[model samples]
Target: MHPPTWLTAFLDLPADEFDAAVAFWQAVTGYSLSAYRGEREEFATLLPAAGDAFLRVQSVESGPAGVHLDLHAPDQVFEVRRSPGGLAYCLVSGTESERPAPTTWEDGNRSQVDQVCIDIPPALWDDECAFWASATGWELVQGGRPEFRRLRRPARQPLNILLQRLDEPDGPVRAHLDLSADDRAAEVRRHERLGAQVDRVHEGWTVMRPPAGPVYCVTGRVPSADPT
Candidate 1:
């Protein structure tokens, strides 16, 4: 497969929680909702003020509600498939070039929803990481910790791929969004004000559960760094 020209993270919400999920995400990301599309009006793009949007929300009729990534490349028919570790991803033809700026909070802290962390069972870790690095044609940067591996994203690409080695012996692969913030605590507090709750606070990142979707993390990384 050709290297993706762009990457977009999609929050797939169930029908019953669609509106609430859209509202919560829009509030946290400071993005304006675009007109709903799709046959059932179940898809909407989150438009950024200064750059091309790299995020969207969709109402799903079946299957689990969670996040998925869209790999955008030029001149291709849309296709969806499961990764070696079983995470679902889409290949779309639409092209995107601009990357959105991080949102600056009232407290002078900045944050961006920049990375998608794939949680893979220990046995699947090696193959999963190899598949992603080859599939995306991005530089694979070995993580400092043994449990993590990151893709060194291209300059214009909006999202980073993080492969997390789970401790479990075997299980279905899953993914979660992660926000890098200048001040992790402040960002967590802001999200809490928007109806999110702290799930756990680790030394390097804070786990958070939004009012209406799967859990994510607020990490202590710089908002502006592409983690290149």
Candidate 2:
């Protein structure tokens, strides 16, 4: 079988705001910084204390901040698509070196990014989902809600992808990260202390806005299992 694809979450930010974004994210995710990449120094990777890194930050020349994914498949290539607001993703071939496994945080708070939700315009929902499904070779599962669909990775994979169909068909497509937390309330508080403001609460999930970054969610889902 082909090796499991390595997934990395990319946080795209304005050039001027990139540093603040990286600092905020590093604190919230408990990750350290890796040397910047790209000729323009627009790329930086977030390294977990152990295990493969699944997060990165990029400074874009223009446009509002957003999120996207990078899939590293040894010998695969995929077409890139740009949405209304310039959101796009591409798959490239590369080898991912393994790292030390992750351990519990010193503060004893446990959290990890377990899902990425792509917000797509209703008109492009089917096509977008098809593209991602094809790129990742993940199975598409019907979502519990009418406007949602899930592209689940294999059991051995470390992250999941979700597609959310928006009511407005002309809006820009964007994405956000979802972190699993064992103690939802405490996790929210921890992020708040680190400069994230609670945007609102939906169901049992807390929508948070980082000091100067895109919004993300902290859910009560267990970090060690598939999110409900």
Candidate 3:
């Protein structure tokens, strides 16, 4: 199959915590929750007020809470597969074209869940990066930092793709959401007020554990900046 033209990020939550996770995500992103779908109502999309949806949530029957991606390629029937680095992803079809705007919080600071970061073991980094670049047909931009690489996404697409080489030698690849914030500290405080906790602080980003979902990061990147 040809490379995917569009993609949607899925926040896979444990079955018991699904409702709470959805609520937390909605408050953080300012997105409306779509009606739940799938047998047993296991799926839902987070609807942006101004753009086509690009983020979804799944109430998984099994497996720990984590994130995944659905690559939207033409003519592809739904299928699940693992990348070279073992990150789980789906192949599906979609026509999402309008990118959503960054959410402005009550304090005037802005943030957007603009990227999905794939954490890859050091040994598999090269192969994993190549797999994603070929799979998505996006330009792979090498990062200045040795540990990171980026896939340049189309402006109309809602999320950018980033591959991070982990210090570990080998392990399953994992994915997480990344929010670009206009004021990093302010955004962190806002999320904290919503029940999230700071996991760790880095030089340009802070890791956080939302009250109900997988851990993610709040980065110092400007919400309006091009996500290269």
Residue-by-residue lDDT tens digits, candidate 1, 106-211: 8888899999998999999889999899889998888868888999988878888998999899999899999998888888889999999999988888999988
lDDT tens digits by residue: candidate 2, 1-228: 233467778898998888999999888777899998889988988887766777889999988888887777787666455644456875656566443232345667678877898988987788888877776778888987888899877754557788889988677778999988778888889889998999999776899998886899998776773222
lDDT of 1 at 211: 84
In model 1, pairs of residues that clash are: none
Higher-ranked by lDDT: 2 or 3: 3
- The per-residue C-alpha lDDT of model 2 at residue 127 equals 82
Q: Which stretches of candidate 1 lie over 4 Å from their true place?
A: 225-228
Model 3 lDDT, full chain set = 0.88
TM-score per candidate, chains pooled: 0.96, 0.87, 0.95
Cand. 3 TM to true fold: 0.95
Ranking of models by lDDT: 3, 1, 2
- Which parts of model 2 are misplaced by more than 4 Å? 1-4, 76-86, 97-107, 225-228
